[model samples]
Target: MDVDLPYELQLVTDLRGHEERAWQIAWNPVEPLLASCSADKSVRLYNYQPSNESLKFSHIHSIPTGHTKTVRSLAWSPSGKTLATGSFDSNVGIWEREGGHDGDEEAADWECMTLLEGHETECKSVAYSSSGTLLASCSRDKTVWVWEVHPDSDFECMGVLMEHTQDVKCVAWHPSEEILASASYDDTIKLYIDDPSEDWFCFSTLTGHKSTVWALAWSPKGSYLASSSDDLTIKIWKRVAEHKWECALELKGHERSIYSISWGKGKTGEESLGWLASTGGDGKINVWDIREPPESSTGRVLSHKLIATLSSAHDVSDVNSISWCPREGFEDLLATAGDDGSVRVWKVVPSH
Candidate 1:
């Protein structure tokens, strides 16, 4: 079905069996595994094959030791060896992947490494830095805490980022930088940068969205940022100078609240197409291509082409989260989890 735009939705994987809605889905950074957490108080990990788009998922393990309520968010370490889950029980649990390189023989060796408790209310999101050295979490209590990860030592609370006046919805680490970006119900995106000599602090605030900003992501180059919001728009910003940035473009096309946004692959040259993929409450996934402006006297802003639009992508359910594979070779594949109690994988194929 065409929704007044371009883009095709092909069902690559139909991951079912969840008893409740899935709030978060993450693609493993090192392996072809997909981790998803749900309101049913369960966490599942699936092994996906990108060659033929086959999914062989087993309940590798479940968290019975941490949260007494629903599990809402999860994040995998940069090494993909550790998984962090945040839940409504007001705590975060770190899960370690046990067992040696040998397969199923040691599959029952997983364990909960630690329980991070600080938030006075339900934790909304959790993310691990690119180096696997830090983890950041946000909650409904209107606080974001940064944690330092140690191998043989106890995890330390590095710092707490307290700037949002309301609940923080999402937190993302820049691909290769020490900067972090957060979005909140206060309709703003805050950038946190650490000084090499001192602590981390809010360096800048991006104010453009008319509604709650639900998601934020940094481009792989760490030069640009993207945010999606309930205002049904996606805003792209570029860091021009030290501690200075501005919104380069505003993409308006979605009919409902946008829940997630991600950058696509093939961005390597001046003429390379930088794609933005978004999932929304209207049950659609939209792909937009950011193009450079034409050479003319009229200084028009850069334009984005609607490359793809998928209607009924979740079949009447709201897509709550979407993530692109962070590894080098898997850029064309995307994964999304939704209120439909299913996780779907999509592969982008260029039109001839």
Candidate 2:
């Protein structure tokens, strides 16, 4: 809790669960659920409760991903029913909560529904498309894979994109379109879209990062994409036209490799994309306020204000992942995973 934030941020809770570095954390879109995957080869799910204006969490489930190696990433389905975990073991596990029936209590039994296999090496990241019909995963094998998820947990490989020259670090989908984006160790970001023939193909490759591109996030309206990199800078890109994206701005401040970034409105009832959060190997969490373009600014000329910087965000460990809580009423809440093997929650409240 550094006192230098341009905005106020309060540490709500430090969730202790994983015995190894927690690599990723994701929030359930429609529930109090927060799930974290770790190098311990396990996924821990917690139920977050808001009590007396503070965030409290109860560990509801700890699942063995059945991987021989680190569970590196986690993604929840749009319906908030399924959790997809990617592992260094080269497999993906899909988990679901049982006993969600009418009379069941708040706690539900969790079970791994299915295991998706195919990547030759580490499955670095997994993401569900906005529609929930498609899942996209990237790997250290330097490939981006898309799957068509069917009923009864059946998944068919829709496409395999292997254009990146090095390890693919993260994959993200457009908010309202079938477009997919992947960042890689090759220092580039590639965009893909579905063709009418039911195929996914790369449409554009974004360059300019000086080192490995670690993670990516899309804006609330899907108009812009933000990327974090080993170059220690976060780059913003705007869609200039269909199939084309241009660099909007390059943000520099992190002292080491940035591992993850997320976008949030930072408002409970209001509709605004107020800021973006980025966490890095430097153990700091930075809040970059997304500002409106200047009145005289032309298209795609963006600006950002550094509103907050929380030092030692993970207590002397690299912060691996971060996500802004998607629950409508708790938009200011954030979850972060780190090398410290713990998941911490924070809430931003106006400091005035």
Best by lDDT: 2
Segments of candidate 2 deviating more than 4 angstroms: 1-5, 100-107, 268-272
TM-score, predicted candidate 1 vs. hidden true structure: 0.91
What clash count goes with each model?
4, 0
lDDT of all predictions, in order shown?
Answer: 0.80, 0.88
lDDT of 1: 0.80
Model 2 earns a TM-score of 0.95
For residues 76-189, what per-residue lDDT tens digits would candidate 2 score against the true structure?
Answer: 999999999999999998888788544242557778888999999999999999999999999999999999999999999999998999999999999889999999999999
- For model 1, residues 1-352, the per-residue Cα lDDT tens digits are 4555444555677788678898888887887678888988888777754354443444455555457888988999988888899999989999876674555522645578889999989989898888888899998888889888988526898788889999999888887777788899999999898777888889999998999999987766767798999999898887889777789889987799999888765433455446778997987888877765677636545577877777778899999988877677666677888898898888666543
In terms of lDDT, the poorest run of 10 residues in model 1 is 50-59
TM per candidate comes to 0.91, 0.95
